[model samples]
Target: MRYHIGDLNPEELLDLYRAMLKPRMIEEKMLVLLRQGKISKWFSGIGQEAISVGVTQALREEEYILPMHRNLGVFTTRNVPLNRLFSQWQGKKSGFTQGRDRSFHFGTQEHRIVGMISHLGPQLGVADGIALADLLRRKRRVTAVFTGEGATSEGDFHEALNVASVWNLPVLFCIENNGYGLSTPTKEQYNCKDLVDRAKGYGMESRIIDGNNILEVYTKVNELCNAMRKRPRPILLEFKTFRMRGHEEASGTKYVPEKLMKKWAKKDPIANYEEFLLEKGILTEAIIDGYKNEISTEINSNLKLAFDEPAIDSNETKELNEVYQKFDYEYFEKSEDVENIRLVDAVSQGLEQSMERYNELIIMGQDIADYGGVFKITEGFTAKFGRSRVRNTPICESAIVSAAMGLSINGMKAVVEMQFADFVSSGFNPIVNYLAKVHYRWGQNADVVIRMPCGAGVGAGPFHSQTNEAWFTKTPGLKVVYPAFPDDAKGLLTTAINEPNPVLVFEHKGLYRSVYGDVPKNYYTIPFGEANLLRSGESLSIVTYGAAVHWALEILDKHPEIDADVLDLRTLQPLDVESVFRTVKKTGKLIIVQEDTLFGGIASDISAMVMENCFEFLDAPVQRVASLETPVPFAKNLEAKYLPKQRFEAALLELYAY
Candidate 1:
């Protein structure tokens, strides 16, 4: 079918024209507010509103749109109240994010619009996941995700496309190729002549459009939307346009040469489309002015209302609001008796129970389906649950994380496994920037658990043996749990799954097989911010978790005179400060041991907390023992030397002497 401006009826043509004009006027008002010092910043979509505004008009309300910072026109097209948009820019409590976020970093669950983080590339992978869910449920709805040409440089762009192609997900990867990435032009940004060429390798459909023509954009996207509903597949749509202004209002257009600016000036999307409507006799000048005046009045009234709304108080925003999902403890309680089980067995069992209890729970990882995972932790799971629930994903770690985020956002619970915790660096953007901050920024706890099999001691090299829980602990709105015993591991995993928050479960591979104890067959939870006291002693307090707890116990057994109180910190993010203070007051000396590197490790934070809280009770300075700063070595001899036994023993002796 031929797709063009002629496809639309007279009313539809006028609707498109009004849609473009609304955002154009709103941004003009925003620039005025920016200059008047009312709003902090402005990202104007001055010349590039056509694709977003037009394509949004083509989409159904049930469909999802993942928009980046530049897509103000999409909001206008979706009929997002002008007051809310202005309130967001003004950082008012009445905004979508309740003043926690600004400039495209907001989403409403009712609208089915997932906001894009500053690092916008990863949301495409999330879009792929949302599309995957729709495909699995046979929803026949397409998810359109927007990104600039610069974001295409991110790894998530490639990963999202590859997975969407392989799974035949109904996702529209909308690329606004606006000639430059910040100050650098497209020539320097990528080697490809056209960005759509990259989609050829992924075996997906591609289309290039003159973004200046609003009707052409609407017709083409509308056609693709219908096509994807029948047979799901990703389509890369490249919109060639210009930013017309600076990257942000403050950045200025000094980078663009006058000659190039003049060239793009003639092809402004709004002006060009307005002329098209005039010549076609679809809209008279009087009718157009009437629409503009009506919208302008609406905009001004909303801005006034937004200004009158009370600002959020500083005390109200001081603490994180609703970081975790509220659930009764009885919901997670199991009726079965306790049984002796290995840590690994407890993990698989807990997972099976969680899945059976909650039908929406799903597990995804590399080699998790038939292969039963790298360490056999998921053995017999695929046979019991089937491949639909126990999914085997590709090696793209970021995609897995982002995909899980999307699923969680759509009212499903997900447990994602990183084959090895050390590989999490590959997927850090979505985990840290998107998943971790979603609750704090957008008021929804992403209900997902990432099972991280971490730490050294096995023959696995540096790539597989690193303990990086400290990195995630530092991130707000993220819960980090590290369990030492089989019972704790099973209980914590069960609890983490129940909580409506993005939790990182650090399962030490060394402890998975090496440890065995009584694990409850019935579901029970060890709450966050609670510490377990394994052995009591009066002389010293030894705080540790995971694999280090066993090592600390071994050292204490070797020297009975040390008489240490061993405390296991099950959850790191919500530290058990009360227990730590009590133990510090009783023992009068603190020794923190960790398997992670010495500098900036968990021990450092605990040591500081101890000094600040119970310093007067201490008989000596707080001591911390940890692994060497160097990478974990492959050689057994070098690895043993780098490990934390000798250092811990020395610290123990010094504390004993003190």
Candidate 2:
């Protein structure tokens, strides 16, 4: 089948020509600026303009597109303000990222442009998320995601494809096969005959197109996307093209063969399209020069405005406060109307109530839908809310996290459950880098709640029993909560779900069913930055959370004489420094406990903060009791040795004695 300029009216042809030409002109101006040292960097998409601009033009206004650094054509074609793009390159405050980052390292929700991260593959999964939201809303919008030939080697690439295929998502995977992953050639990147053939391995339909041919790229992409909207399935379209310049301005194209560069230069998309338009009597030499002159005029005008823009103000940013959205909230404590339930049941009840309250709530995890999750936390979720609400994703942590980000972008609350906290390592990049920082980089608050079933006690071995909450706690733009009791669990979980930030809820696996407490029978939320003083005394301040909270209490139960203020830190990131300091000042002594290894645990941070703030009131030096620096062992005795229980007991007794 063939389609050409004949298939389009004169107006559509002119728009397409303008669309393809604008990015080239803008980038040419940027290159001159780059040489003048006015801009620090530029990733030239000189030869690959058609793939980005043509595909973007084919999509509807509401459809979301995830473009990469080199796909500036996508932004230009979407009519993103030229002043802003130039300002972004100049690191000006008016840029999309507010100078927090430069280049296309930002996304503009208004433009439906979710830009890619430097890692280059997580956006693929995020695309799956946007497509999922469109599917759920029953919207006829196809999400188009751009990727290079190199990113096809990433696990996130396969994960995104398989997930979109499995869910039959309306995602158009536009793979610009520009022949290199930075400097590595396509022959060295993958073993497949073509990137499109690999798409078939995931049971997805695919086609290869002449990316330089603007006519083909527009006609084919429009046709495929229209078909995708009706059928609502993922399609992979590999656009064969070349990188006519260096990977970036800094990297010279010395590595690229001169012969190949010359070959592609003759196939330059703009020049060829202009000639084609002229032959079809749709463009004259005079009109072509007029387009170039008009483009250059717009570029110079925007540059003048953007160059005058001020840089990002450091004082006004208030870096930490900008990480999260600020709103007044109440901490949910145990109400007189309560029922005793295990910790896991408290989580279940909280999640159920939240789902009931927010019809837009969606829960996803591996084996969470039908199998009820590895720990049976979501046992009957699928039966109640059906598959759309309670989704079972593939074991693609990165993809799921990015997908959750995508869902949140569309104004839906998403909860992702990791079977075990240790599994987060696989998804850490998206969780820490993308999901955690999205709000800070741009103003898009990721309404995501990741439930991490963590801690060591069930002898699940290192793979499943890691207390890794500290990994995310220290990361800015992420809220980390570790609830000790059922009341706190249910309440805090409620808040985490309802909040408009990326939050990590660490549910200690050991406390899942072992501990039970009274929780409100109805829906409620607990505000962050509030600590629970489980037990009070003047002798010492026992600072701890999660399973370690139980360990502290048990030690005190054994020694009734050990008078201490046991503080359960419900939320770690928005830490309750006031309660910690107050407790420390009253007792003039402090002992922090955590199940994680001693060196880099959140307990260490608490101990340091106490010393920094309450040092003058301290009766003695601060004490920290944590697990040995080793993985959680499978053996009963080995696991016991690896826990901080014994150390916590000794620390508690000694601190009280001090």
Candidate 3:
């Protein structure tokens, strides 16, 4: 389409001008606040306000937005109350995150804007998922995600764009080419001349506009957005602009050339827009001054209110007030008829049952469709639920996680599978930063279950065989579940799906087909923060979970002389603390065993808890048996030496003697 200067009506043009002016002024005030030591940091969008305002103005009221930190103009344009914005920046209790997060790190489900984190690019896939949900619902809406030129280097950028293009999702990926990432120039950042050119590789429609010119941005974005609503497809829109300031307040522009700064100053978005409006007889100097005064008074009043608001108490900030939504699984009834089932089959059955009960549930993973998965845990799922519900995703772990988060955000219970638990390292940012904090930060439901095939007994080597439960357990706002038995596997998996929170299920790879037990045919849910007493003896307390649960049982059954109380902790995050401490009191001597490495594992946490609670009850010092600190070796004998059994038996004898 040809660029038209007069596309937007005069009233719309005036609104756009005001929109650009709002953030520019707000950022200026934020800089002053930063200097005053009120606000700690400021990511200014002084010269780049046009793009943020124009893009937001082009969108419909209901369209979803995922904005980066610099896009304060986008927030103002979205009709976000200025008081709340000030409250968030001031770190007051009235902030969107209740002062948990400062600055632009706040969003609400009501506004349909998923807030950006320090890790910016993962939100692209999340926006894609929202677009996917809109498409599924046949809703004529677009999802706009904003990021900087440097973010194109991230794996999530490529993954999100590829998935959106392949699915023909109604996603508008807006890249603000502000010439620098922190202090590094765009020339040094990437090999390409224009980042928007990469859109051709994904078969997406591309457009580049003068970001400083609000009319050009508004016209082109408005046109494309209208077209996308009719036929959903991803659009890569590049806004060529300038930051006009350092990355943040403390980050001065000493590294930025003076010449470039002076040149961008002449092209200030707000000043240029005001000049154009004045020349066109659209806005007189008096009207412009009145608008500026009105905005200034509004900002000052809101700032005073926000500044007067009390800060959250230090005691409140100690732990994230992550609200866990209680799930009632009355529909899940235990079956009297027990059938011998493999752990893997039990997981598959549990998923099928959940999907049968909740039709909105969807399963996604690599090779999970026709191929079932690398472990075949999702075998026959596609045939049962069809390819729509049981989706086969790409090898990109981050995309899978972010997209699943988006699915959950859009009211679908997403059950995603990580091909191997080790591969989760690639998608760790979204899992830890995004998915985990979604509900805690925004008060929205992040109902996604990530099934991780964990553990290292079968010698799958470093990349494939990592017991990463501790990684997720350490992260707040996530529920971690690991089950040792077939019954618990089915029950817990069901619970994870039903629960309205992000749950990471660590399914041991070695026990998938190797272990079998009587599992009920009926649906059931194993409550979190609950432990099962596998063996009732009191020589010592052997607290363990997953594959190690059976190992501890084996050791006790073999050596009846070393009789012990075995407790299986099903959930790791909301740990079964009461049961563990009770058993520790009974046994006096406690031995914590885990399949993960000796250092930085769950065993240390259990030992510390025991020391804090049952220190006086101990007959001897607490001992722990865990895998060696080294990475899992490829050789079978070396890998076997690296794990428990040998360590456990030796620890048992030493503690028995002690």
**1 or 2: which has the higher lDDT?**
2
In candidate 3, which residue pairs get closer than 3 Å at backbone N, Cα or C atoms, i.e. clash? none
- State model 2's lDDT: 0.89
TM-score, candidate 3, is 0.95
**Candidate 2 Cα outliers beyond 4 Å, as residue runs:** 1-3, 330-335
Assess candidate 1 and give its lDDT: 0.87
> On TM-score, who's better, 2 or 3?
2
- Across 376-475, the per-residue lDDT of candidate 2 in tens digits comes to 9889988899999999998899999989999988778899999888999999999888988888888788999999999888989989999888898889
TM-score to native of every candidate shown: 0.96, 0.98, 0.95
Candidate 3's clash total is: 0
Instruction: Tell me, by lDDT, which candidate is best.
Output: 2
Sequence-dependent TM-score of model 2: 0.98
Error of 3 at 576 (Å): 0.8
lDDT of 3 at 303: 92
